[model samples]
Target chain A: MTPIDKNSNMPPESEAAAELLDTQLDAALQSYTVDAPSDLLAARILKMAKATPQQKQTFQDIETGNIRQENVLWREKRYGFGIAALLLISLTFAFGTLNFAPSDTESDTAEIWLEAAADLGMSDIYDWVEGQTNSMDDTR
Target chain B: MIYKADPDQDVLTGLMSGDERALKELMRRHLDRIHRTAMRILGDAALAEDVAQTVFLKTWEMAPNWVSGKARLLSWMLRVTTRQCLDILKKKAPIYTDDMPDISDTSDLADKKMIKDDSAKMVRKAIERLPNRQKIALTLSYYENVSQRDGAEIMDITVGAYEALLVRARKTLKNTLIRDAEISTERPKDDRKLAL
Candidate 1:
């Protein structure tokens, strides 16, 4: 191989062969361009533009801010129901204890029975009993 | 060459300007081409429809950025199409096809009309089989007539890298097409060529 100096402006004879190769390459590349779908590109593009405007907006809403707001609302409602149930249960228990449970106690029943006995005084009961006994003895 | 304000650009500009009629006109104009490109890349009509839909929608989003002086709208669409093909390539295993769709006939057309026939489909199949970057480089260079520098920029690769990819892609395509030609002697010819 003849070594050409790097400073030479003219390339070696191999440049001619390279040019032939370039032409062949260009022809080959040209053949591939035969089926470019230039004719039908517009219609397809418009269809795409119209397809998802409403849906995309809806999706963005659901995925971003609106979803968070909905979740917060749901959580608040659930917590409110939970607290209300707890308060209702506590009030029912407290009211039941004050109104109904004392009547069930033995000490309260005993006090009521002693109060009834005191109303039947001791002297009146003895006099009535003696009068009844004398009448029974005379009949016999 | 001065850019022809093709129907695509008209529809794009019209849609951008918020004309509803332009949207319908746009769909009418490019659906078949999108379908064809998708079918070529994916080898499945259903999948092609999906890719075409995606490409069109993306184009709508991108149309505002496309000024006429920058590039032909067709070339821009081709770039978008090829990029979409590359995206699909990255996400899945490569597709294989024994045959390709027949080209529309151009017998009554001018001599300078683009070549179409069984060979075109074979080339498309071979191109589809290329590695992602190589296929992309080849598609933009061939289909869009994009210069090497421009193709490299679109692909976000160095010019040398793009050239290398083109070389490999061409070699692979040539090999496959030659192999297929040897095996299929009784290939069918498309009858409805000039009519379309």
Candidate 2:
């Protein structure tokens, strides 16, 4: 028997061989027969079907609802994250505006202390130092 | 306009309205074919039964939305069967050669019935060894006698592709059987003597 080409067109002799092979193959394939399923098969399927709920809505409705549910859940998650970020930004700005400088009352108290020191002959010490310098110059 | 009434339309309507009798009617119509197809593809009775049950349950669930003329109910069920069988085949490697009868015993004592059974088993084993797509194409075309167009639809492939798969499956099966025959012919004489 001529070998049948896998890709090219078969010649006449090869065609005959291929035909015979096909017939033999078909017969062999038909030899393996299966018996009908048990009676319990239908009963089991019906029992399971009874427990299941049939589709009530249109096919389009069910498909749309599935997609819409996913989108809605995603949108809700996005909104949640957005609100959290806004709160964080607001708190950061509130703390950044807080003043850390010394108060006006502290500044005024410091000025008063300096004036009191001046009132307590802080200038007389300068004049005594000037007179000491004049005596030193006359001694020279 | 002549509306050719679909025979299953009434039962389908009843099913959608929650009638168990309609479901029974459907089983009476298609259960055997569905179960047989599953059994051939899966080659395991229990798994075949599971596939059949799942296909029916799916039919019931889809009954409400089943458009009357979109596709034949049998085609839809068979499509489901094929998909389910493929899924099972993916998860577990099918044991095709296990428990197979020894075909090499060509002794004078071998009866005709034994020879026939062995031949059938050989064919079945060869088929099981085919790739899943080829196995399915052969099963649908040869066993179920499904038309190429319907088979294409069931397999979700073009008709040309389905035909090509069938051709490849037959060629592979033929080559395998021929190789097996040559091997059996070349078996050592000692082995035959031992069988005797």
Candidate 3:
């Protein structure tokens, strides 16, 4: 971009304001130096190289494309395991039918049924029915 | 040795080839600037050291792909250091009141450069008082001398936004300096010395 002209018919007050700013900025810039620590470039390059994959140096262009692939694969592996575990838990809950009865209900009904059935002797009747059925079962 | 044309590239290539000495060379080159940038942004020597160390570690980790034009390596490092400092700033909201070390007031190159001076410290404190984006713009323009494009890259803002921030920051800093000048004029020299 070309240097902006502060004077050329640019609204007078704005132009003056711009000139004042340019002056102050020049002063501030002069006072400072963004020293990149002369040693840092080599260090950073070495550091980045060390940090980079060997495949990257040997194959810079290929590595560029592979880097994204590695990230995608890493993400897939992480979520893949999580999804697998989730599916396993869901399947177990869905397929594993369970039977349960309250302890109080079982005990309460057991005594009452025993007392009521004493007069009728349902067990004996069941045994007698089983015996007669056994004798006649072949013809029937 | 490793890709022999450029020494810096050679060292980096060597490091990629697992040559340990290349690591030392790389660290030597950037440590000071990284530390200084970190110090300015963080305003704490210890935290600056940590930021510097982390930037180097990340650099070392990213070495193999240090392709020449992917980014200006130093600016990339500065960007990393700036980000680390910003993260800390977000958590602590540090207020810098002290002067930065080795900052000089003399614009003349011939003058003996002052060491561990208060002027830069005041300036740095004043900079910290700026809005976050403005502080970044000022630092990038004044200290880093990064062109608008590189500055935008470092700050992750658009070039237009970066320019706007710089303009706003410049205005704010000028107003602040003018205010300070007025205040100094009203105070006696003895009072100024006492305040310092």
Candidate 4:
């Protein structure tokens, strides 16, 4: 125990009697142990403390429901994105099969090229251009 | 904020605020002594464990209402555990000597082991045979290391009454051991003893 207070200057007889009492008490208490608790007692009691009526809501209680709601929101967003991506892919495929994907550049360039080639022949190309411009204005 | 200096108050505040860590800290601080008190009084490992758990649960429930400064938390715990053990003892017809742990020393040397084991066995039996009040007083004051004043507070008795209980307990235990020693001197015995 705390070194028996060296500075107190107790008498040797009293000290000896105290030592004798100590020895007797120690012998009597040899079989008794202050070590009866279970090793996991703190953990078990802490777990029990959770179920106490005073604990309004534990973190796990709040996190569990919130996590489920987050999962639902995440799932809805994923499903919406998946359907939109599928529709976009399907529309692209439909356009490609209908020949619209290649038609704009290929067909327009072909018409321009054919018209330029015909104009290069120099056979009334200016007259034909004027006639085409006049006909477009008449139609308008 | 609960100051760190006052751990019991800290834990009480934690209990009020639903802090499990505080509960764990309190359990670590006090459960060993509480369970030791119960085990010494009841002489049963399983029942002592149950009693220790029940005492803590009761403490947890009563935390919100526990007013500091009226009594030390440890003294209160002692009272609760003491009452729970006594209640269990009252319900059971006779406390079981079989539940006493073999506190005998088993050493390498044969003679030393024999002497130690014999003394411990006799002492344990004498303590076990004691009346409930005497047994509890011995368990609290001697084994639990509780001071006489606090022991009396736990027992809800006066200091003189507690001292008287300890004196009577010591006398009874001495007489029981002396009687057993006389019987052993005139009798045959076997070292190989069944636990039951």
The residue-by-residue lDDT of candidate 3 on A1-140, one tens digit each, is: 11112232234378776675566546643554334444444554555555554444325566555455557878789899999999999887766643233355468788788668766778787679889999899778
Better model by DockQ: candidate 1 vs candidate 3: 3
Please give, for residues B68-166, the per-residue lDDT of candidate 4 as tens digits.
667877788889999999899888846433243333222322433344335665566567667788889999888778899888988999999999989
Shift in Å, residue B41, candidate 4: 0.3
Best by lDDT: 2
Best by DockQ: 2
Model 1 has an lDDT value of: 0.57
Evaluating just chain A, the predictions reach TM-scores of 0.28, 0.40, 0.25, 0.28
The DockQ figures for the candidates are 0.09, 0.35, 0.13, 0.13
Put down candidate 1 lDDT per residue, B58-99, tens digits, no spaces: 656555445565565655665676677667765776442223
- Better model by TM-score, 1 or 2? 2
- TM-score on 0 to 1 scale for chain A of candidate 1: 0.28
1 versus 3: better TM-score goes to? 3
lDDT of 2 by residue, B1-196 (tens): 1224666787888988879999999989888888889888888888988998999899898787887777777788899999999999978775433233334434332332233337776676667767788889999999999999989999999999999988878877877666455444434444555354
Q: What ranking emerges by DockQ with the best candidate at the front?
A: 2, 4, 3, 1
Off by over 4 Å in 3: A1-14, A32-140, B1-8, B43-46, B64-69, B94-121, B187-196
Which regions in candidate 1 have their CA more than 4 angstroms from the true location?
Answer: A1-51, A54-140, B1-13, B24-36, B61-79, B94-121, B179-196
lDDT of 3 by residue, B117-151 (tens): 33444355456566666776777676656689878
Deviating ranges (above 4 Å) for candidate 2 = A1-13, A63-140, B1-7, B94-117, B188-196
Model 1: interface root-mean-square deviation in Å: 11.3
Specify the poorest-scoring 10-residue window by lDDT in model 2 chain B: B108-117
lDDT tens readout by residue for model 2, A77-101: 9899999999999998878766554
lDDT tens digits, residues A1-140, model 4? 11112223235468774565445445655754445567777677777767767624345555666443556888889899999999999999998889854455567787798688777885487679889999999999
Q: Which whole-number lDDT from 0 to 100 does residue A17 have in model 3?
A: 62
